[model samples]
Target: MSRTSGATTSPGAALAALAGAQFTVMLATSIVNVALPQIRAGVGLSDSGTTWVVNAYGLAFGALLLAGGRAADLLGRRTVLLAGLALFGVSSVAAGLASSSGILITARAVQGLGAAAIAPAALALVMDLFPPGPGRGRALGVWGAVSGAGGAAGVLLGGVLTQALSWPWIFYAVATGAFLVLAAAAAFVTTTPVRESGRFDVLGTATVTLALTALVWGLTTARRSGWTDPQVLGAFAAAAGMTAAFVLIERRHPNPLLPPRLFAAGRVTAGNVLMALLGSVWIALFFFLPLHQQQVLGSSPLLTGLGQLPLAAANMLGSTLAPRISRRIGATATVTGALLTEAAGLLWLSQISAHGSYLADILGPSILIGLGLSTAFVQLTALSVEGVARQDSGLAGGLVNTTRQVGGAIGLAVLATLAGTVTAHAATHQPHLEALTAGYRAAFGISAAVLAATALLAAALTRRGSTPTAGEPVPAGPASTAARAN
Candidate 1:
């Protein structure tokens, strides 16, 4: 049998495993939010210590993503996937069993390291399973749906597990899921050929990793301590210095961590840029929307999680329709429309009041936001990898994910700081609830404006997009004849 035939024979099983791997990685990010209170009480953690629990995962995940992606290209995708899953599962077990703050934080950081390896490798495998075109588009649509829903599901699952069982159960559940995916991946996923290129650029890798680590650390810290805080400024300075060093290293190194040629492809650059903007709104939405539901509306954690169901459903629908829409209207138009839709939702969401009902204040906007964000995510993700060489597929995956992650971190910090300032000023004259609502309103309104502006920029950037129509397939190289299992 042909290599393509061998890869395509069980596309369903492969997609399922890949999707499961990615889902678990995303789930770990937000699953801890609802359970934070329980975790704090259980471990007797201080506020600062508790904050580190989340930051640790994000820091490690963001920092190591490029390295992981490069490793997958140099090593084998299947090998990296299995190793990542093992580490993630073991770390999760350690997190669940931990009784001290230090142990839990360390475990979460280790879990993130594993996730960094899993995310890029899994995405690259998806690109490998289905070659570029409608088959790839539809496959990525499923990938998009799960990716969007993962955050929503994490919130719901965290509430359920924490309320019914305990916080540690959340960690245990992820561990179990990771092991299952690991097994399925081993059985179904095919190994792709690794490029026999120049040796790894160890200096390039170290510099970039440190840069991202410092940047993420600064952003996360800025949210807690004001942006002008000395330590936060120091971290930012360190990130800038490290990033500069990385660029210099990549320029001189024989084997660069990120090839400069990758950015020569317009879609790769534009896609990453747009994804960052979308990610800003995406992360902030989850943060503020939940706060509004719980703090302003006085909904229980369970109810807040339940309220996200509509948004999740709408997101899935949008993702399902993304390929068809892109085929009909083209990628640029589809992305522009999606961004406008999300902006409208955010504008509406900004009108949220202290005396608001879920149906009246939240549900309508949530639907629009879900549909818009998910579709945009699908299209932009496709655009990022379009025309990328097979050898650079893993790097593309890592770059896109890194942009989203970094963008989210930056967005959350800025928006949260702005909201806090608004709340503080309003509290002097307004009722506490009203003051809180005002701050949320400011955040949503600003986000809407940002998205609207980004829509214009996206249109301009992707004006020359050569994205194929739905029925047209790109010239096949590897893994082109995969069955349309979806």
Candidate 2:
């Protein structure tokens, strides 16, 4: 059998290349937030239309993730990574050059497709680079740090680029970074022998992708048309039907994109469940936070980006500290504590006022939310892949990411819709700024409730002591790799 031991190149170079690819994938998700106003003005998009610019990428990325993971196992990890980078680079440039809303949204979706491929393949490569030991643990820590930091850093970069140059420069910058990573990867990352052989589950992929698309569309459309609107109902119905079909297809497929057996582990299920909740809050936080800064506080894009620095620092610090904390406490306590901390922070954030200052209203909560969110993300990620068999590591990686992205997409849609509804109702008597603040407050409040509930569920559902202790490295391969894939 071909060696499944490690990367052929120097481990450091390979890890950097893999991590860089993952960072770019995450950066694309949040970098557009601070520039949304410019993008809307430049493309003449409606508020609802602008939401699609964000949703389209997330939808595609979440939908295609399982397929991408499977492809990496069957085709080749390095080949898939390279192809994803090229596509991502090209599409980002296309997005940057687009003159119309349709073109930009389409480019963003294509970028998502590339991201779908990049994320799984790069993560799998990290697994291939190191065995399940301290080397792998340290590598995964770096991955977690970058993953957590990427979102905050994106907003900062987006602000600088959008203010200094233009909104399009954000895409241009991503393209530049992607191409640079592609080059580095080509030079340093070696091809791994294809470990699994199976034909693509085309029907399963189609049904699941369509199901996710329909669900997101239903949620997003509900904001404009009332929840009971026939169109919204139809979208939801279609989503349900497609989801049922996908589940049935998975049951029979000789090579299912997502194996039903993977859900048997309580830890995996609880980890993913909480991940969805966390993702919903994570994605919406970025979306609403910047808008609140710009719209309510009257901060400039650059100022909004700079304001994210504290949150970014806190996130990095949390990620750095999570494994150590997990070592001192168990993963269960660590994760639960993190969730409660996040919920408290979100609750604090829900009190945002039209006249509030950044220092008083945003800064403390940003730090709290950032630290809690990052810590929870790292621990849950480790929990998610705690017991999977070696052969299924790649699929587990994809599944965890899929849950996070899909949850974010759906969560953002839900929160945005709720906020919009609240704002509309409040607008009858309140000033526009106050109305907007009311909406944001409602979203944050709901997010806090969801997180608190998630914490309770996570505590109840996770098997106590099943997770690795802090001293014991979170397994990345035979029951481990999916942890860092987050």
Candidate 3:
């Protein structure tokens, strides 16, 4: 075995490279939000039709995340990373130059597929390169910070590029970043052996991907078609059937995409649940916050991005303090406290009016929620991966990410539904501004409830400070206990 670790590199150089790649991936996902309006106008898209541009990418990326992670474990991480980057660059260029909305949407979906491959591979590489300890914790913190920062910076970058040049510039920018990361990855990453020898779970991948796609499509279509519509009902039914099939398939498969044993522990179950709920809330905020700033607050794109800076800054601060806090209070308590703080912030934010001031109404809540989410996310990631064997680390990492993406997709669909329903109901009784405010308030309220529930779950499920002792074989689950005793 190679004794060289990432720590041998210049202090923090490896972390910087990892964070740079993570930032670029996250930036690609978010920067498109600011350009949506321009793209809608340029391509003559209906309001409903335009949303597919974002959803297409999100769905593909979220659905394929597990398979991508498995690929990283089986193939070389470096190879997967490079392939993903190349695919992202090619798709971005296609999206930038497309003349029609259909072509652009297709290209965006391809870009999402690339993201699914790249994100897990990148995360797994980071974990493998940095040995598990305080060094790993710090690197994870930087990763979380970069993820948060990319989200914040997206609004600013998108606004500048869209206003100064065109919406296409967003894709161009992502392509440039992808190309740069590809070059850096090729130069910096050393080759590692494929650790897992099991056959790929092709059937499991297909069923789960289709199941999730059906679920998201059903939820999204429910907004326009009313849940009673045949299309919506059919999609839901298909999702249920496919999910059942996935369960059965996984039980018999020698190498399942998601091992059934991973969920045997209470901590793993709770972590995955909390991740889903918080993930949804986080994505919903990103989707709606910008809309609220531009549409309700009458802020320009650049001004809106700047106004949201408090949240990003607070998130970084929260992440930086989390490891220390965890050491003192334990992961469960720390995460619960953070979640409660976030819940309070979300509740306060739900009361915003069309005439609300940014500083008085938004900033305080934004900061609190940012702090809460940042702290909770780090702890959640730690809990999910703890006690897993070295070889299965990549799988654990992928599952954590998949849970988050799936949760975000669900949250976006549910919030969008609530917003649409509120707006329609209010429009029937009141003015346009009042209707929009009603929609925003309803969405925020629902998100607050979700966060509160997640907090409660985390408190009930996670135990205090359960870090594994050095060199002790990380137990897989209940079945592994018998094997260990032998």
Candidate 4:
């Protein structure tokens, strides 16, 4: 069932177009993670140098997200999306064919820039295409599900390609997916009128991007170089100075990249915080869990990938059911329940021992986390855009996604540092294997705490009420006020 131009397309078709692009972008981001060791070996990279491969992409993507959203609003979304896909595809091929670590890292940075362009544009497009009702709710629900499933699929795909073929095959596979999505988007997506009146906030964009990049890089480097290191301290100082400048710039600029008014509302502030915390927990799980399955459990790459299938399936089911459940219970309650469930699941997962069985110890907790993520994601998307005017929807959507990306990047860096610290401490008294497992446990415990914090934030912040039925507008609230004020 293909959607064609000028045909009355179903909500499912519209969602497929949006979700397919999201899935491809997410898959490209994560599929490289599991194959990092192989890539490092292949390209003869030192441990410090290897970390850059992932950080380069994340830093670029997170920093440019808001600017990308503004660009989508200025230019046509369809045009920007197609351009992003093409850039991503070309970069993927470049990374796959690279013979040196430097070349691959540079290509990955380019891919991040492409992803920054694609993600916010894709989300804004969804809000544009779907009306505010049950149809839009269902579409967003599927969108959330596809995103969770895509993360798991990336791990599986990475493992499969790295084991059966080579690490480069992962990039090759992503490139193929990007091309397919590009074709579908070109055929089905309709063009909208460009906004000639709105001006781009170049100063705001540069300041904010630089500030965030510096902050994240400093935090990440502090893990490896110690908190007292000159480079770490200097980076943090630079970040602080730049952030202050960004605030000043935004206040003065007529067209700001991130409008200060967005943070004035209590609910919007809370929602963004929750999104960031949830993102951090989710990214930590994907990064560390795979390591445990392979290194601690002594499983083959294929078996490790297979072990994650149940979680992926459960995530899909949760996303599919979230809309209906939210209608019955309310969005706030649904999100709260998801956060608690995720926290509990992570806590349970931290109890796994070296002698634990996969099905007995891992599968149950994995399923719980999957359900929690699916439910929270759906609610987050809904709440982020709720009550916003049509014109501000793009900015609202961009903020939600930007929070997630930045949170994920920050979380991964912190957790990696924690893991290293635990491992080093344990190694002073025990074997390497024992130390590694201990580190994994400590990391999971911290992740559980983060999820718990997010749950509390959600409970405190989210407003109580059912979403509007088909063809109805979202009720006015603090979140809506923030969007407009911005």
Best by TM-score: 2
List, residue by residue over 349-403, the lDDT tens digit for candidate 3. Answer: 9999888879877999999988898888887876676654444555666788888
- Local lDDT at 276 for model 3: 83
- Model 2: per-residue Cα lDDT over 1-486, one tens digit each: 332312556989889888899889889999999999999999999978989989999999999988887777666777888899999999999999999999999999999999998887777777667654456556666677778788888899999999999999999999999999999998998754444546889999999999999999999999999899999999999999999999899889998887766775437788888898889888899999999999999988899999999988888888888877877877778888999998999999999999998999999999999889988887787667656554555666678788999999999999999999999999999999999999999999999999999888878866477557433654445334443342
Q: Candidate 1: which stretches are off by over 4 Å?
A: 1-8, 44-51, 469-472, 475-486
Question: Could you tell me which residue pairs clash in candidate 4?
Answer: none
lDDT ranking from best to worst? Answer: 2, 1, 4, 3
Q: Estimate the overall C-alpha local distance difference test score of candidate 2.
A: 0.85
Ten-residue region with minimum lDDT total, candidate 4: 1-10
Winning model by lDDT: 2
Candidate 3 pairs with clashing backbones: none
What would the TM-scores of all predictions be? Answer: 0.92, 0.95, 0.93, 0.93
- Relative to the true structure, candidate 1 has a C-alpha RMSD (angstroms) of 3.6
- Model 1 residue 136 distance off true place after TM-score fit, in angstroms: 0.7
Error of 3 at 227 (Å): 0.9
lDDT of 1 by residue, 124-231 (tens): 888888876678888989998988888778778877888788999999999999999999988998653444545677898788878877877777677678789999
lDDT of 2 at 318: 86
Better model by lDDT, 2 or 3? 2
